[model samples]
Structure formats: C-alpha cells, structure tokens
Target chain A: MQDPQSQIVVIIIAITIVLLFIGILFLVMIWSYNNKKLQMAREKQQIQDAFEKQLLQSRLEIQEATLNAVSQEIHDNVGQLLSYAKVQLNIMEQQATWGQEELHAIKDTIGTAFTALRNIARSLNILKHAAATRVQIDMLYLPEQLQINIHDNGKGFNVATALTNKEGLGLQNILNRARLMGGAATIISQPEEGTSIKINVPYA
Target chain B: MHIHLYQYTQFLSLLVAILCYEGLCKYKLSAFLPMLVIVNLIEVTGANYRALGYIPWLSNHAIYNLNLLLETPFRLYLMGQMLRMRSNERLTFRGIAFLCMLVILLNYLFLQGPFVFNTFSLILIQILTIVLSCFILLRLALREDIRPNLWQDPYFWVNAGLLLFALITLVILGLQQYMQDHKVMLGGKSLYKAIMPLPNFILYLGYSYAFILCRIPKARSLLSS
Candidate 1:
C-alpha cells in the first residue's frame, strides 16, 4: 500500500487532469465561437463594400449622362444661335451707311461673342470626353482604412498650375469633399497625360 | 545530465522565445525573454539542487516558496500589460498582486514557515491566476476587432495556457491533503509524481507556440489595439 502522502498526490493529479480537460473544453468553445463571429464580420464587410461600389458606379453613370446632356445642349442649341447672330450682324454692316463705326464695332463685338460661345461648347465637349473615356475606379480595403483610386485616360492639365489658379476649383472641390468625409484626395496629372485621383478614408 | 521531460519542454520554449526575439521586441514583449530564462533556471536548480551539492539551507521548497512570492505578482503585472488594461483595472490588478504577496510573506513567516511546501500560498496564487486568466480570455473572446485573428494572437495562447495550468494546479494542490489521508493510488504509483509534470509540459509547449506566433508580421498590427 502506498503512503498517505503519495496517495494524496495521486488523487490531486487525477483530479487535476479532469479539471484540465474541462478547461481545455472551455477554451475550444471560446475559439469556435469567436471564429464564427469573425467570419460573420468579414462577410458583412464584404457585402457593405460591394454595396458601396455599386452605389458609386450608379452615381458615376448618372453624372456622366447629365454632363453628356449639357454638352449636347451647348453645342447644338446655344452654339447655332450665336453663329446666326454673327451672320446677321455681318449682313447689317454690309447694308448700312450711317453709323458705320458703330455697326463695325457691333459686328466685332458679335464676332468675339460667337468665338467665346464656341470655346465654351468645346470645353463642355472635353469634359464629356473625360467623363466617358477609359475611367477606372478601384476600391482597396486595408486595416481600418479604405482607399479609392479613380483613373481617366483624358486630356489632363498641369495639376500644380490648376491647383494654384481659378481652374483648380473643381479639383479643390474634390479635395474638400474628401476632407469632409474624414479622408484625403491626391490628384496626379500633366498636360496630355492621364489623370489619377487617390482618396484614403478611415473606417471601422 | 538526466533532464526531465518538463525541463526539456522548458528549454524548447526558451529556444523558441529566443528565435522570435526580434518580433517580440517589435511588439514590446521583450520581457518574455528574461522571464523564460529565469523560469528555466529555477526549474533546473530546483530539480537538481541536491546533486549539484548546493547549500543545505537552500532547499527546493524554500526556493519554490521564494519564487512564488516573486513570480505571482510579476506574472499579474505582465498579464495586465498584455491585456492593455485601463488605469483603474491596472490599479486593481496591482492591488491584488500586492495583497497576494503580503499574504504569502505572512504565511511563510508565521503559518507554514519556510521548510514546508507553501501549499496555502500556492493555492491562493493559483486561484487568483485562474480568475485573472479567465477574465483575460473572456475579454479577448468578446473583443470584435481581435476576433478575426484570435488564433494568431500570442496573448490568447498565453492566457489559455495560464488558465489551464492554474485550474489544474488549484484542483491538485487544494485536494492534496484529502487524497494523502485516503491513500489514493493509480497504477501502483503516486499520481502526483506521474502527472504533475504534465501541466508544466503543456504550458511550455503552448508558450513555444505563442512565441512562434509572435514572429508573424501581422501579429503586431493585430495587437496594436
């Protein structure tokens, strides 16, 4: 027969083993539970990202269509009206004798106005091209951060000069909007070069 | 030298910790390196004190009792740091550790003395450790941010191992006197001698795995919160 001390030690060990097994069981249950939660969270995030991407695509399509409509209006309606006025002014100058200087000045003013309207129509067309050309939007998900990149193969302007001058208001608006959303935007462009805009935001 | 299985496991854990020192340092867990070294030294010396012809006064029981006085509080502090406990929680843990240390000193000086195994203090420390480990595990399980990479977390493994070790030791030591009085036996040998080392082995193995996990590049980011 073993001594009482040894017997006690033996019992302690036996009971300990049982308890350890129980402890292990608890750990395994926690692990399994947490893993399920993590998987569910990942799936939810994926769904949200897909939804956001779709929403963005729809918004872009609507914006493109609106720009196209405006471009067409300026080129077909307003542009033709300006040209007709210029032609009328020219005919009036050819027929009138009195107030000839005034008529010439009027004709020159109309000619300048026609040229300005045409320039405006051409600028709208360029904007339409930018909206319709090869444009790519990529959404990159990082830990706690979301990055978006928009690229367009359209005639690009000097980013530095545009940002410093009145022409940069559109770019400034983009930057300001991103900042309002707790994000930042970066635009990369050069004359005749493609444009790429990157925005980074933090999300839970 | 005839190294015990438990000792071998300890060495293996130490080796893994050393191998992952760079990664551990990056995460500010370099303390584990010295802690493991100290634990191995204690284990080796305690096991081979007589053969090495150490002073008669420095018995294994006395060494272990001293270790208990020091190790328990240190471990609590480390756990608190790993869990990123708030200031209030940290204060509470520090208070508990201080109280435990005080109790251990009183028990050593007046109650059990130094010659005998400080079973009372051991049980108290083990119970406290079990509670702390449970709290940590619960916190980890409930945290959504860490849930995605829970398995890769070194603290999860460390806490799990600690919980298991504390639970087993608490049960075994708590019932030691009762079993001894009853002459309990298993396979004609004292069950304590046969199985006591198992928990240590399992714990060290878990630690080794945790150190390996610390080497993962993403571990730092996962633990940043």
Candidate 2:
C-alpha cells in the first residue's frame, strides 16, 4: 500500500510513458508513409524515362534507315545520271555548231546542277551517320538559346580518351560543328554510368 | 476575472478562422468558423463564471460538461468529412456517435448528475476522439492516393492536433480522477488546472496552422495562374 503522494507519482510516470509511446508511433507512421510515397514517385519517373528512351531509339533507327536509303539512291542513280548528263553536254560542246557563249552557258548550268546534287547527297549521309550514333536527343527552345541534350545508355567510354583518340572522329565532328555554330558542347560519361551530351547555341 | 494563456490561443485560432473564411469555404470547411466561435465563447464564459455572477445552478463544471456533448459530434462530423467517409462508413460512425451521446447523457443525468463534473463522459469523449483521430491518421497514411506533401495538408494537421489533445487530456483527466478519489492534492492545485492549458494551447496552435494551410493551396493556384 503506497502513500497517496507515491501513488500519484506512479500514475504520472505511467501516463508520461504512454504518451511518449503514442507520439513516437505517430511520427514513425507519418515518416514511413512519406518515404513510401517518395520511393513510388522515383520509380514512376524511372519508368517514364525508360519509355521515352525506347521511343527515341526506335524513331532514330527508322529515320537513319530511311535517310541511308535516300543517300544511297542519290549517290547510285542521281549522281550517275548527272555525270552522264555532264558528259553528254561536254560532247555536245566539243561538236557544237552553235555560238560558243551559248554552249559554255549550257555547260556551266549543268556543272552547277551536278554540284548541288552532290551537296544534298553528302548532307543526307552526315545525318544518317549522326542518327546511328545518338540514342536520345531532347531539344529545348529558350528565349536566347536553343539547348540540345543527348543521352545514351551505352557502355560509355572514357570521354578524355575518346576526345584525344584518332578513332573518335564522330566525337570531334560534334565539337567542331558546335564551335562553327557559335555554341558549346559538353560531354559527360563514365565507364558504366552511360553518357550525356549537352549543346547550347545562341538562337538568332 | 482572469483569462489563461490557453484561452488566448483559442481566441487566436478563432481570428485565423475568420480571416481564412473564404479559403475555408473553398475547401468546404466553413463550419469550423462557427465551431471555433462556440469553443472560444465557452472557454471565456467558463473562465469568468464567478466574476460574471452567473446563476448558482449554471456552474462552470456544467457548462464544460455541456460543451463536451456539443464538441464530440461536431468533431466526429468534421473528421468524417475530412476522411471522405463513404455512405456506409458515415452511417456506422453516426450510429457510434449517437450511442456515445446517449451513454454520456445517461451518465450525466443518473450517475454523476449535472452539478458535479462529468468525468465519466469526459473520459468517454476523450477515448472516442482519440480512437477516431488515430483511425483518420492511419487511413491518411495508408491510402493509395495520399497527398505527396501531406505535411501541408489541413486535415492532417487537424487530426494531429485532435490526437495530441485527446491523448494528453485523457491521461491528465484520469490522473485528476485518481487524485480526487484518493483525497490527494498536488501542491495545493488541481492536476487538471495545472496541466489542462498545455494541451489546449497546442490544440489551438495546430488549429491556427490548419486554418492558414487551408489558404495555401488557393494562393498557390492563384499564383500559378
């Protein structure tokens, strides 16, 4: 049989312990719930990123294949046709009974047409090669700059080694193109971490 | 006449409720405004009953006991609204609330009588509120569509406040009962008087924050537009 004061003390201690337990339990519940929500959001973002990457890869493949075919057709058929036409014009110039100035003008016009045809074929080939190397490309239009971000989930190479090696012509070409367009390109990659390339160019 | 610090907190919460009336209406929580007004009025009148020379029959204990009757259903209804309880769940809770009220009325009329403090009903209300608040919090935590920023949620704050107040008050009130039954005194003051204000202060602070939180989403939307 405890005294009244001692009994009161015991009751107070018991109540304090119970309140403390409840408070801790409440806090733990809220913390775990918020943590679960954060984890779910992260997983959702990852899935969305994977989907976008897959879609981009498929689109790039199709575009590269189509452009390759077009470049082949232009080189095999159009170039041959232009060359044949130029040869025929040369022959006609050599045997022409018309005014010399008129024949020279016809020959010059054919030469210009052949040069334009070759330029178009070369540009298409460049595009096909670029599409083959890239895994994903995102373009963002800003007030004064156009930003392009390219990401690849590939076995990444050492960026410094690639930039210096003769075999890294594709990497060098990207840098040179960006410099020529008054822009800058940044390449980030690690051995197993995948690659990211960002290009920022002034929009004029 | 004297006003305690806890009563000031309740008044502050009422001010916030009034200021956030439009935002509360937007969130279908305008009922809290009138509820808070009633709560503050009760606190003020109860605290100054002696100075105000009220009728002898209208004791402070009776006023508070009556307040318990009004507060239980009002709080349960607000929590149900926050939970978005389905029709069947709402019906079940309403039934439970009715039973508790019936029990409280019976205890007040037959067991404790009106003049004496109704500790039984107070304990009953505290337990019921604590259980309901815990259930609301658990549902909020486990629901599939739980808000990402739950800390900013108005209902979360409200339930947290309710749970803290109920848990603390339940223990304190029980201790008060023990002291009374055992003829014990704690430094010449009732344990209830010494400790009651702390939970009240915390509860009203939480209410003020919740009222402020009710306006935050509307402000955010307006800013975005």
Candidate 3:
C-alpha cells in the first residue's frame, strides 16, 4: 500500500546511511591504527632508554667495585710489608752486634723495599698518566692482537696473594681491561725472582 | 551432498573457531565459539529439513527465531567480559540480558504463541543487540590505553565484527516486512537476496580472521599501556 516514489526515497536514504556508516567505520579504523603505531613507538623508545641506563649503571658499579678493592689492598698487604721493613731497619740500627755483613744485608733489604715502593707509586700514577696524556693511537693496519711485556728485575711478590686477594685490583684491573678488549692479561712471578706482566689485547 | 558457497564458508569458519579455542579461552572468549557453532548447526538442520521436502516449523523461521533468542544473551556475555578486561565501566549487561530474555519469553508465551514465527521478539532482539553492539563500539573507540595493536586483540576484532553485523542486520531486519510486502523496493529481487547474506558472510569472515590473529607474543604480553 506504500507509494512507489516514497519507497524509492526511503531505500535511497537507507543506502546513503549505510555508506556513510561504513565511511565512519573506516575513519575510526585508520585513526586506531595510527594511534597504535605511535604507542608502540613510544614503548620501544622507553625500553631502549631503560636498557641503556641499566648498562651505564652496571659499568659504573664495576668501576666502583674495582676502586674499593684497590683501596683495601693498599691499606692491608703493601702497607704491612712496608711497616715490617721499617721495623727491621730500626732493629739493625739499635743492635750493637751489627757488623759490615749485617749492614750490607740491611742496605740490600732497604734498597729492595725502596724499589717495591717505586713500583707501587708507578702503578698508582698510571691512571693519572692516562688522563693527562693523549697518546697517539695507531689505527692504520691495526693487527688482530698486540702483545705487551712488562718485566722488572726486583724481589718478586707472592703471586698467589696477588691473584687470590679479594681486596686487590692491581692484577684484576689489568685482566678486566684485557677482557674488555677481547684478550687477556697474565702475571708470572716468584719470591726472590723477577716479575713479568704480559698483556695480549685485540684491536681493529 | 551438494553444499553451496555459504555452507562451505560456514564450515571453514567453524573449523577455525574450534582450532583457536586456546587463544579464545585465554581472553575469556570461549563462550562465543560454542554459541556460533550452535547457530550454524540450527541453520544446517533447517536447510536439511527443507531439502528433504518436509515443512519446517513455521516455514523454517522457528529455528531462526530460536537463534535470535540464543544469540542476544551470548553477545551480551561477550560484551560484558570484553569490557571487564579493557574498562572500569560498572556495566550490568546481566540485568539487561535477563530483561530481554523475559521480553522474548513473554512474546513467545502470549503474543506470538510460539507456533507461528515470533516476529515481535525477533525484531526486539535485533534492535536491542544493535544498540548493545553500538554501545560496545563507542566504549572501545573512546576508551584510553587500549591494546597497542588492536588488530591482534581478539576482543577488538570480535566487537568490530559484531558492530558490522549489527549495523547491516539492523537495516535488513527493519526493512524485512516492508521489503517482503514490496519486493521491488530495492531495485529488484536479486539485490535484496544478495545483500541479505553479505553481512552474515562478512561477520563469520571477521570472526575467523580474529581467531587466527588472536595471539599475545611472550615478550609483548603486557597489554595496552
């Protein structure tokens, strides 16, 4: 019973409405997709920053741990040996039975102690030297590895103590540096013998 | 059996829905798949009955009317669970569902009397469903801090499909009686017939795609913001 023209108008209106609704759906879809992409990008950036910050914190912690161990070593082992040497010198000076041989023995002992003190001072000064000097670095034809040997003809230290002491960074720092370069550092020494420090480091 | 394109699509959708049951359960969307399967089965049964030369109850509309009744509550359940995940909206979809169910029951008991097609209840359910679907879509679109990739989100795809289905179906159902009375209202018989199945096909296709895409990667499991 509906008029033909009225029915045509209603159908046309319905189709238009449906098409407009579909358009709105598509607009919403595009907006949602873009918003999601932006959110993901923001999340990825936050994750990257968090990872970098953690890496920096851990590196600083390693450095701090090494420094604390080194400070403890200086106060304990090296200081004790130096104090013992001073006590021996004082005893030799006070004793009346001290002869030329005794004097020579004391003199040799004092000389050995002085050389040890100088070695400790040089080791302590190496960091300051690195900071002050801008040494020329050769990058041309860089080898796969570069080996450095440091030898000293002085009364040797306890290799076991240097390697095992928890409160010592002298040898460990060298090892850590070598490891960072994808290489290694090895120490060979014995009591009353000479000492050798070997460093094998990789370079590009 | 001479199965047509619609039947083939329906079976494929059901297969995919079953296979993605794990992903559905993870997001509490498992209830929807069973309801879908039941609806499909009812359609297939109705089709078989007609093909066998048997007169279907109320000319095959009883089964469809039953589908209408079952589908609304399932949709409300899905909407409630989906919203519970993404928003803090104190929705009482359960109460709305119970009320709609009562309305349908009253129509079936008194008005339509269940022997004939429950046209009143059918139209009512369709309108209510369309309104609920729109509400869900609005909440989802305006809600802040949704999944970073809404495409991969099962609920997003599900609700999107529901909204699409509801929108198109609303127009179809609203004009059903009018179109039946006046077949030439939409240009011709062919156009109306073609358009009727299109929304249903699109709805199932969307659900299948959603099932396949609904996975939370182990690293990306921390959803939304």
Please, what is the TM-score per model? Answer: 0.72, 0.70, 0.60
lDDT of 2 by residue, A68-105 (tens): 87778777766666676677677776887567776676
As a whole number from 0 to 100, the lDDT of residue B92 in candidate 3 is: 56
Sorted on DockQ, highest at the top, how do the candidates line up? 1, 2, 3
Candidate 1 residue lDDT tens string, B1-225: 556778888899889989999977765667777777778887787888788776755788777777776676667667776777889988887787788889999998899888677889989988887787777787888885734456777888888888888887787655554545565556775555556687787788888888888787774545542
Backbone clashes, each candidate = 3, 0, 0
* Interface RMSD for candidates 1 onward, in order: 3.0, 2.5, 4.2
lDDT of 2 by residue, B6-111 (tens): 8989999999999998877777778888788778888888888898686865788787777776676677677777777899988998898789889988887899
State the weakest 10-residue window (summed lDDT) of model 2 chain B: B216-225
**Which ranking of candidates, highest lDDT first?**
2, 1, 3
Model 3 lDDT, residue B5, Cα: 61
Cα lDDT for residue A177, candidate 1: 60
lDDT of 3 by residue, B1-225 (tens): 344466666777778878888877877778868787877787686566566665546356666667666776777677777766333344455666788889888877787765556667766766675566556555555665544555555655666666666666665655555555566444544334556566667677877887776555524744543
Where is the poorest 10-residue window by lDDT in model 2 chain A? A125-134
Q: What share of the true interface contacts does each candidate keep?
A: 0.74, 0.26, 0.00
Off by over 4 Å in 3: A1-13, A16-204, B1-4, B45-56, B85-91, B112-123, B134-148, B185-187, B214-225
Best by DockQ: 1
Candidate 2, residue B55: the lDDT equals 82
What is the Cα-based lDDT of residue A48 in candidate 3?
90
Query: How well is each residue in A22-48 modelled by candidate 1, as lDDT tens digits?
Result: 898989988888888877887898999
Clashes of 1: 3
lDDT of 2 at A136: 81
List model 2's recovered fraction of native interface contacts, to 2 decimals.
Answer: 0.26
